[model samples]
Target chain A: MFRPCGLFDETYAKNIAIVRTRQHWILIIIGLFIFLTFPLYLSGRILHFINLLGITLIAVQGLNILTGFTGQISLGQSAFVCVGAYTSALLTVHLNFSFFLALPCAAIITAVIGTIFGAPAMRIKGFYLAMATLAAQFLIPWMVTNVRTDLTGGSQAMHVPAPSIGGFVFNDQQSIFYIIIPITCLSIFLIRNLTRSRVGLAFLAIRDNDLAAETMGINLTKYKLLAFFICSFYAGVAGSLWAHWMRAISPDQFNLMESVWYLGMIIVGGMGSVIGVVYGVLFIKVFDISIILIGPRLTSFLPPQLAQDTAAGLAPFTFGMIILVFLIFEPRGLAHRWEIIKGYFRLWPFKY
Target chain B: MLLFVQFLINGILVGGIYALIALSIVLIYKSTRVFNFAIGEMMAIGAFILYTFLATVKFSLWIALPMTVISTLIIGFFIERLALRPLIGQPILIAIMATIALSLIFKGIVFFAWGSPIICYPERILPGEATMVGKLFLSNELICTFLITISVFISMSLFFRFIKTGLFMRATAEGHDLAQASGINVERIFAVSWAIAAMIAAFGGIMLGIRFGIGIGTLPLVAIKAFPAVLFGGLESVLGAVIGGLIVGILESFVGGYIDPKFSEITPYIILLLILLFRPEGLFGLKRIERI
Candidate 1:
């Protein structure tokens, strides 16, 4: 909402626009140009990282809507992502459905499943609700592994066919970047608009005080379920993308730890803000990637007995330490810092 | 019928261990209101510490046991002071995530030190023989575990009932501001509660290690299993933890015995979902009334 000096909006449309000034549009266009053109210059490995980042961004955005906006904590998001991956994989492999068709189907089915698990949110709340969702985290994977071994390939990894559009295959990371980046942008746009709407206000209200929101006739059941539906839908999309991108799916890929990492991303990025999701995901992912890159080299410096264990342990140790440091010092997350930086520039020559 | 009795006895004894772990969780939650998801990691680290002293360092049982307890207690105290103390007034979710973060750190430490092998105590801490009680065989280790668990519960109850520190902890659990107004050092109580919880978790971990080798992989799962017990007893009720643990243990044993071995792994979570659906307050937890 901070505008630079000499910038004034005369029209309501101009005032409410997300990209308010010409400067804003220019920056966004430049950012989008860099994002879309990354594959041309960047290595295939980096492209793969971007694809994962974009997919995770979408998932974290959904989580932002649920936990960050609606104040419902979900520890089972990875399970929902698992469901989405499995659903899409099964649809394509078994029914011979197109990737496009399977993607939507995956998202919808995941939404339905998420709603079922979230139904307990109506009855329980806080830690109890977290426990209820935790059940889903365990139960869904168990079902996937044990229920239909023949169909799901049981605990063994299932091969996922690369997504294709009318004989145009997205077989590699570079090609998948085109599919992933655009969808990521679209989701960001949609969620940005969503948070500015009436429903977003209702979610904010409920999050602040559910009892008061109920008194204000916000219909806690409808909005809470809606948040879950949307959140899982995003997870489903991410999972479908992940399945195609990896060309293989396994239950281990989507575990409780993955869900916790997603939560960590949102917390670190700044909860309730769409941009925060991007910051959170990018920060955590980049940190993790750096750890992976640096771990081997760092381990060699240590004594041989401690080297292997330290190599395996450094990522988690640093990651956990960062999360704690952020929670203690910058609890509002990187988004708050971003806001402050932007505000400082906007209010140049005047202290506000 | 005789086989059923044997399973039942096994369930009760195993349940005692679960109860001890649940009590640790309840103790911290009661005082600090932070749900310690790191509890499993705490247990693992405790067991690993004991393993290090007994196996690697070659310390006698008498020295190693008390040393492990003291180390864990100190670890708990530092965790509260360093990691958790700053998060006191934060949201419940933030607090929970802090514990999760702590869990990750502890996990990394365990992995760094022990390297993921299933290690056992160097020597058998409890007798291996099983006592035959009219065709129902009871393992002496389990009986000892059950007795220790019961004594802990009894002492904990008495501590909360009569001791001055216990009284202060209870008062702090009720309300921090009220306790502070009455001249109770709420911060000290928080530290004490965490220290005691860590110690109890270490005890539970040792018992579990005695039964099953101390593995980084399966200890967290045991903590997850204890969650249903915590919920079943009500989050705050000490007695409820015991009853809930027993019920979960019995249910798991029966399900594992009757249906399939794998079903037992998920039974506690299933019960947790069911409990949340029907009785969110738990059987013994005080019903909370939300006010505007």
Candidate 2:
């Protein structure tokens, strides 16, 4: 609907399509082709890194819906992931369900649990809601580790079987990438459409002003809980995918730090937009992975004791600095920057 | 019964330390309307500073104690001036995220300085002997810490009630714009509140370090534990934080002693969730009303 320059939409379907122009379609195809063929030329480590990005993007996408779209901050995202991971793992290992069958089931169960936790959002907002949701961060892990040691494997990690689709086993890194890529693309496409739908408008309304939304006859309780459910469902799918890919699950994998990282991703990428999720996850994850990779090499030149300290502190210190800088100077995030660049190109040959 | 009493006593003693930290959090939230997530790091840094001064620099307790408090107060003031001051009029979410970043930075700094090893405070700073009183044994350090905590509380309560500066802080807490209109110099009050909070956190940190030794990861855990207390007592009420801290401490102790040790870890959070469900504003907190 929003046409710039000489761009025009001739049909209703064309106007609503995500890839608006022919140029957009061509770029998307080229991007997908590059990603699809990367395994041929890239190392297993790089593939593994993309695999992590894919999984985290899925979860961050969920967080974008809750915190970004709906304006409800949840520090309990890791807990929701834990539920999904454990549920999928349990269904496969204990009940002998297939990975495909278990993944959606796990997501649904996590959604139910997420909805329960999100019930407080109707009455509380802002920091109070953040604190209340933190209960999930503390409680879910405790429950997994303590309540039923048998099903969850307690403090010990549970093993997952390699998922197979009609005799093709997704066991190797490349094979897992095949599974991850499709799911990741599907999630992005679906969420992109979701944010453009009526439900998304309601979520945006709630985020902007809950009281105003309520007065406008938007059922705060229903929509807020729905956002929680949908968001947690995304986390569930990510957790399920991760579990099957890693072939092992543990409470430690989905901890408070990971939840915070997911939040940082949305904050850094830009909130309220679908593509922002991608940019945020890619930026933070790449930064983080680079730190892990380069930290040791950078520290090797220092004295052994000091090196150890520096190596330990470098990642968090830099990550914190990035978050601080973004919040202070560029609170709009990477997605906003992307738009600015696009605008510059669109307005090229003419000074603003 | 005696065991229960022992746990109760231990809980109370530990609760005193939590009360100190919760009070600091409550102070900042009251005055600045910002829930500082960096508090645990503040405490950890304070403890580390005390360790550096006393163990590394060879300062005596009498000198090191005041030095640690003063330096930590300055650190707190800088955090407000640098990190939080720029965040005025921002959404609560952005401010909270900033504090989280500040916490990470503080944690990184401490890790860079001291690494991950647990650092023990010098034993000479506090009495180490255990004393018996009617079949119960109490650590002399715990007793000393408890006494200091009581004195701090009494002095703080008096300060808020009577002192001119404290009155300015209270006024500022009531409404920043109103206080500014009344010529209260709200920015100075904000800095002072943060300083006072930081000093209290430093005190708690020193005591806890003396009790359990200071570790990078465990120091921040204190802030997480203090959350339920701050919420339970009410974020805006100092007295509420004190009571909430004690309740949480004793609840954790009883649960750990009776039900399961693991339950103690989540007891505070569970209480927080329950409190939020039943009373979103908290016991002593003012009801927040949304305007259309």
Candidate 3:
């Protein structure tokens, strides 16, 4: 807000006018060169990281639509993802379908399930609905494992054959990255369009005041269900992509903990924005990998028992701490920070 | 017939304790107007505190229980002060997330301290095998749980009805701005509310550890279990918690015992889905509050 409003830039002009430092063309060229090389660097060892990032970004975006845009709290995103993954995977594996066919199938199935799940939204809000969603998170997996053991593999993972686009199998990490990047770009575009449409305005209105929205003839039930359906559809697609990427689907792949991770992503990245979703997922996951990378080296400084004992526990502590600090200090999230920086650059010459 | 009766007895027994867990949540939400997502972890810490005081140092149940309650109260106070107080005027999302973060923190700290080992609390205080039956059977755990819960409820009622501080707390909860305007110390009430909520959570945790034989997994499980109870009862209603707990407990046991053995968690969730679909207000919830 301050960035676009030009408070900091104006303040800087008034206070710090004596000295100036500038970057040369070589520096800018070097920055652009590094920026362009990031993909080349990533294309070698861990192009699959992009696929995982894509899937997580989709999940986070779905959550942002529900929680940030519509003000509908959901803790059962895992359950919806499970629905999509299972549906899509089953289509490809059991029904002998193509990847494109299976993807839409997954989205439809998850969207239907999501609407049914969103029925809880009619009754509960804030925390109660959140807990209800939490129940869905655990229940869906348990049901997939135990109740539908004949279809789902229970504890064992169900195999998904590698997806092929036009007979060329995306059987490897590098090949999978192509699907992930394009789908992510498409998802971001679709969400952007949707948020600008009549549907999005209705969503915002219902989020602000459902009673007022309904009084204005907005049809709260319809829009609320639509939000759930759309949100779940994206999760389903993400899950399907994940199933294809991992070449398998299992109940453990989607859990209550991941649901919280998704929520945290939207919160950290910036709620209700595409960029926020990207930033949140990359930030948290990068921090996660950092712990894994640094854990062994840092813990060696302590006693062996303490070092050995903390291997599994440190990531959660770090994550929890991040959430607390962010909530306390920067509840609007990192996207707001991006806005501030962008605003600084865009309005440098003007006095407005 | 015997198995059915046995499941019924077990369900009722567990339901009593579940009701107790939901009460702690209800008490806090009633006063603070914040849903403590960390309730399960709070309960876990309570049980861990009791375990550490007893197992780590070799204390009796008589001494350990009070110490557990007090220590958990301190934890609760620290959390409210450190995390929640700063988020008071912010969006509800921040407060909820703060508890979740606190949940992760407390779980990590406990796991770090006690090493994630399952410690079965000795059934020292709660009696075993106190039963009387002719055509049917009874269990001591069921009887004992109900007795403690009822006593606690009665005590709380008395406190709210008679005690000056309790009344003050109620006034503050009803509307903090109004209460502040009326010369009540709303900040003190907030701290006290968190303390009371923590104490109740600790009580529920000890009882649950006793019931489940103690494990690190019990905290998250029990925390999740408390939801159906709270939802079944209105989130804001005490009596609703007990009724909801019993209903959810019986339904869950009935499903697990008879309907389908493999997928036990599905039944309560299905019930929740239906209740949400048809009667979103819950049995005791206020209907006017449903915005859509």
Give the Cα lDDT of each candidate.
0.90, 0.88, 0.78
lDDT of 3: 0.78
lDDT per residue as tens, model 3, B1-292: 8878877877777788778788887877777788877888788778778887888788988898788878878877777788888888776677778888888887777667766667776547675676867556676766777777777778878888899888997787677789999999877777877888888888777777776755556666766776777877887777888888878788778888887765466666777766776776678976554545
Between candidates 1 and 2, the one scoring higher on lDDT is 1
Candidate 2 similarity to native, TM-score: 0.97
* lDDT (Cα, tens digit) per residue for candidate 2, span B76-163: 8998898888888888888888988988898889978988889797666775578888987777767776677677778878988999
Interface RMSD of each: 1.0, 0.9, 2.6
Arrange candidates by DockQ, highest first: which order? 2, 1, 3
Candidate 2, residue B247: the lDDT equals 88
Flag the better candidate by TM-score, 2 or 3: 2
Decoy 3 TM-score against native: 0.90
- Superposed by TM-score, candidate 2 places the C-alpha of residue A316 at a distance from the truth, in angstroms, of 0.8
Candidate number achieving the greatest DockQ relative to the actual structure? 2
Tens digits of lDDT, candidate 3, A1-352:
2323433434756444322224545675687576444555566546666668788888778877888788888888988888888888889978899988999889888989888878767656666677668768877888788765777787799999888877699898766776777788688778877887799888888777778888999987778888998899899998889888888788988988889888888888877776778889999988988888897787888788777657657877889998888888888789988887787678777644
Write down the TM-score of every candidate. Answer: 0.98, 0.97, 0.90
How big is the positional error of residue A12 in model 1, measured in Å on the Cα after superposition? 1.0
Top lDDT model: 1
Model 1 - which docking category?
medium
Candidate 2 local Cα displacement, residue A104, angstroms:
0.4
Model 3 residue A342 lDDT score: 80
Clashing pairs in 1: none
